[model samples]
Target: MFKSFNIRKKIYYLSDTIKRKNVSNHLKEINFILNNPESNKSKIIQKSNLNNILNHATNTTPFYKKFRNFDSILDFPVIKKLVIQDNFNEFQSYPHKDKNNFKVSTSGSTGVPFFLFQDEVKRNRNKADVLHFLKRSNYEVGHRLFYLGVRLNQKFSLKSLIQNVSLIDISKLTDKAIEDFLEKVAKDKNSNKILLGHVSAFETILKYLDRKNKDITNIKLNSIITNSEHLSVETKTKLENYFNTPALSRYSSEEAGIIAHQTIDSPDTFVVNHASYYIEVLNLNNNTPVKPGEIGRIVLTDLFNYAMPLIRYDTGDIAKTKVCDNGSIQFESVEGRKMDLVYDTQGNVLSSYVFNKIIYKHYKKIKQYQFIQQDKKEYEIKLNLQEDKFPFEKELISEVKEDFGKDANVNITYVNEIPPLASGKRRKVINNYNKNNSLINPALSKHESIT
Candidate 1:
């Protein structure tokens, strides 16, 4: 009576006996966050969980031993990746959960990786959250999921395979690979199919498919989940139309498995995973949480990760938290990390997405554009254009200066091409002034060939 996977469902059982290894009660928790988050029962559950997590942290971890069980969770300091790494030993809880413990690291956004440990509960919760969202996009447990990546290191996953996930390395994606993937899609018509990939990887696939005039109408994709890079409106629409399915941008990180993700109706807004995490939006100046409309740090307190407790951990990303009339929590216009954040002359953080917003309109004329902050109040926009003439130069300069403050110096550099990194991804914005900005690469030139 031993089986590798769980798929059976019985009618009269009190509990679903046939359950997967990673399955948990997290589905109920996730639904509470997504649906009845403001209900009294939900509030009590959150309060109880928070208190328990805090007590566990205080009792077990060396870093939180200073704060007694009765101390407020807010009393704990907001931590970054650097802080954890410097005090790595202190964050670890006692009794270790040694057998079930596993190490996970943040490797994508910043080149420098920060390691943390998570027990089975945390891992199961992560899996459950992902499954919940996948279900929203019409994806089922046994559905075929294709994950495309840029310069992928690990090509295989046992858990992913168990969940029927096929990893397709799109680093140097060949015509044969595209054809093979599509052929599989064509073959599997009865079952639901999913594509989880980087925005760039999807773009490459779309371009290749378009070149060959590939008809994907019969491919029957259940959903397309784009991750890693930002999925622009144009990209999302194209993918959705081609596959005749929903294109959802998943807001996730290695530190926190599933932070937030786009819903079917509203592509822009992300529904925060408040079930597994207690999300706080804190302003740049003081550590206080900002108003719903204002931009601030997307701080998190993992409700489950007692193995390596992350209390008030600043994710370095900026977003506006919106509380709707429906009593649901949502994150809007979520931008890049703190390292890439734009700052005014007075060291006040401004929205770094200004450059991208301004340049997006002229994407046809301009092949690629990058906004670079060379020094304090000194910025340069490197433009790789399709045509020799650009009429918006002066207007764009003035607009950018206004956003950066009165003291901002803005200049435009026309280039033949904006060079891509070794991984073949181009950064839209960068801040070279701050050494703390982990994404900075001084050796990287603004342009491949100056015009």
Candidate 2:
């Protein structure tokens, strides 16, 4: 039966199964920890693993050698993206055995691209962790997955061609593009399909479908998983309404594989993958654990990445934490990356999510967008577009004027590309108003005149 389907996909699935089995022991240990949340044995195992990784990093990795005398984990310095970027080579444990390691690059969304290597074992473990979480959504090994995210520029190998996966580049999303992708998915009647992609990408597709009045009721999906950005209630509800399936959100990064996943029982709350990662919610002012319910910076310690162990790695996102009745820790809500709110003429603070939804809703030709708040009432909109001109620019401006009032000054500029931050992360909205404000204000109306 498998042979009748795509042979390359079948072969890839079989090979993936074998690789997953290779890390069966690690999976079993993780499962054990998940099952026995109250058991001291899990903590003992976790501590042992952390100690082993730390010992290895201290002895072999040049970056961590200075911390050999660190008696407590807290005493160890919290490393940021720049630290890794500056000392790339020092992070590797066995640089001479490059054959045993695979190179992985960060998305550079923060404007700093980080290149790191992972041993084959750590890579397999990451895959295993992903598989375990997928099972929560009733996803099986043979299920067909439609991934909508960043498109890799590399040529697809025979293995990739055979895999039960379809890719749609999120950067090129438009009304016609989304319609064609959905039409293709609608053809596969018997396959159990799963939709996975960045949250914003999913929102873009949903908006396009809504505008075109496309019906997706006949195209049944097992689940919809969103990642890469903060998943808003509005977005999740929209997805669930359109697809008629549970829309789950996942918190993960290129640097650290699966961090947390929304469970079937609670689609809104994220349960941490405590076995693979030790998560900490620290005070933004001082790097110490914040009390439960207080929003703080999310720091993570990867238990399995021996090639480049990330201890107390600040993830640059903020979230409140809670201890459930089962003694498990969960994220109450993710506030997204720390960004200043854009202000209107009346001093009304507008969330970045609000602008994101509005821009994508009004303009179908926009491939990418960024909003820079020049002042309280002045703003600049930078766009990377799929077409030469935005047909709905007038309507979009009207809508913005309605929300922001007529006193607002808006400038729209089309660009070939919007650069990511030094940390390799792209911010949708940037607030420069407060940063530019000084004690002695300029007497010239305190605002730049817009032509």
Candidate 3:
């Protein structure tokens, strides 16, 4: 049955490749560069593409017009989310035409929203890039993909069937909802299935399955790919162990289609998609390129999005980078956003994953939880309960106090709903202390201390 599904997927991809004029060629070119990362041709192609996009941005975009004659890409100032939010009109290279141009808004996970426009071709390229990456994981075009993320506005139709995606709304991630989703996957036993979504959503589902003692062997999955949030080692391990498959972490954003993905060869490190965008790790203070192995802010330049070229756009995430022996740019470790870390009373910093694991353990009753670190000593936890009254409220508080410290002021506020970020993303942990500290701080450089 799996063999038949694979054959059908292959046939569908081949037919679609023939129908699409230039998509196959684009995929081939990207694949070639990916296969030969160290080749001089690859470097030349990347440089040429970057230069072309930079030139286009300078000439056509109002935001970059002032830097038209900029001798070097570095000379141009870096644009932040606030700049894009305020001067949105200036960023557009051309006026939007219905159906021809696609408008997308960032999930405002950073508290500031950014609206972006892309040409139809660019949109197709984004989809192509995703397909190309999936192919590397031995995923065919028509394979079953369980997407546990936002509910797309489009209704189910032929296109949806062709895409072969089963959308599971992250908002409706209750225990019953997860059980139903699992049951549906169980029914389709033969199809090669892949789970893709935000890390928290997958974690929630995993916890639900674990709590119910569900036999994951009955619903086999080929791979698990998580994005939109930091995929921690613990979460990845849990996913891999439960699904009996490799869990791949994808680093991406709405502004940028897919910045990096963990390949089969390098499961620990994320290799940049050189064909789609150019990545640079720059110092947060001066925007200068940081040395290999040093942590720095991520800046990306979209090579394909000509409708609104985003050159040297600060991605707000911090990561360490190194040029591998094969000459590919690899992420050493992604610490996520500067404001994503919580500092405890002992001045020990904790990754957002620390609290996520604790909260998700009680996911059946706690529908949603947001940890807000007001300061080193004061903490506020807001929860959207599955029931009117939380039965384990005392246990939850005790567990939190144990981690935070006995003297710490940990307040629990029950709310009907926790507001999502501008990007419609619900952050598990929010560090209010670092909200205004945009620049990289020395404390954040230290590794996460659980105690």
Best by TM-score: 3
TM-score of 3: 0.83
Residue 437 C-alpha lDDT in model 3: 44
Q: Model 2 over residues 1-451: C-alpha lDDT tens digits?
A: 4433355445655676776646556667777876666689988987887787777778878878977976757656666788887887787777435566778887565446677777777787787788778878767655777887676444655544454666777666767788788888888654677888877677678767766788888888989998777777877888899989999988887778888889677688887888888788876556667898887778888877888887778776677888889888888877665434466778665555667667756455776688888887887888888677777777777777777768888889889987644332357777777457631121222111111
User: lDDT for model 1, on a 0 to 1 scale?
Assistant: 0.74
lDDT scores in order? 0.74, 0.73, 0.76
lDDT of 1 by residue, 1-451 (tens): 1122234112101132244443546776777656777888888888887888888888898988877744576667777788888888898998674657888976545555678999878887897788778777667666677778666656565555556667777766678888887787688644667888877777667767666888878887777898877777777887988888889999888777889888765567888877788888876555777888888778889998879988878787778888877777788767767678877767766667767666766655666688988878889999877678999988888878777777788989998976655445667788887644433221212211100
Clashes (backbone N, CA, C under 3 Å), per candidate, total: 0, 19, 4
Sort all candidates by TM-score, best to worst: 3, 1, 2
Best by lDDT: 3
User: For residues 1-451, could you state the per-residue lDDT of candidate 3 as single tens digits?
Assistant: 3245555566666766777746666777788788898899988988898899898888887878988887877766666788877887888886442446778877677777667888866787787788788876657777888887666554776555665777777776777888888888878754588888888788678668766788868778888888887787777888888888889988888777888888667788987888888887887455567999877778888898888888877788888888899767889878788568676678665655667667766767776788988876788889887679877767777777788788778888999987665343677778886665432432222221110
Candidate 1 wrongly placed segments (more than 4 Å): 1-22, 150-162, 174-187, 206-215, 344-349, 362-369, 382-426, 434-451
Cα TM-score per model: 0.81, 0.78, 0.83
lDDT of 2 at 152: 44
lDDT winner, 1 or 2:
1
Model 2, residue 97: distance off in Å is 5.0
User: After TM-score superposition, what is the CA distance of residue 155 in candidate 1 from its true location, in Å?
Assistant: 7.3
* lDDT: the better of candidates 2 and 3: 3
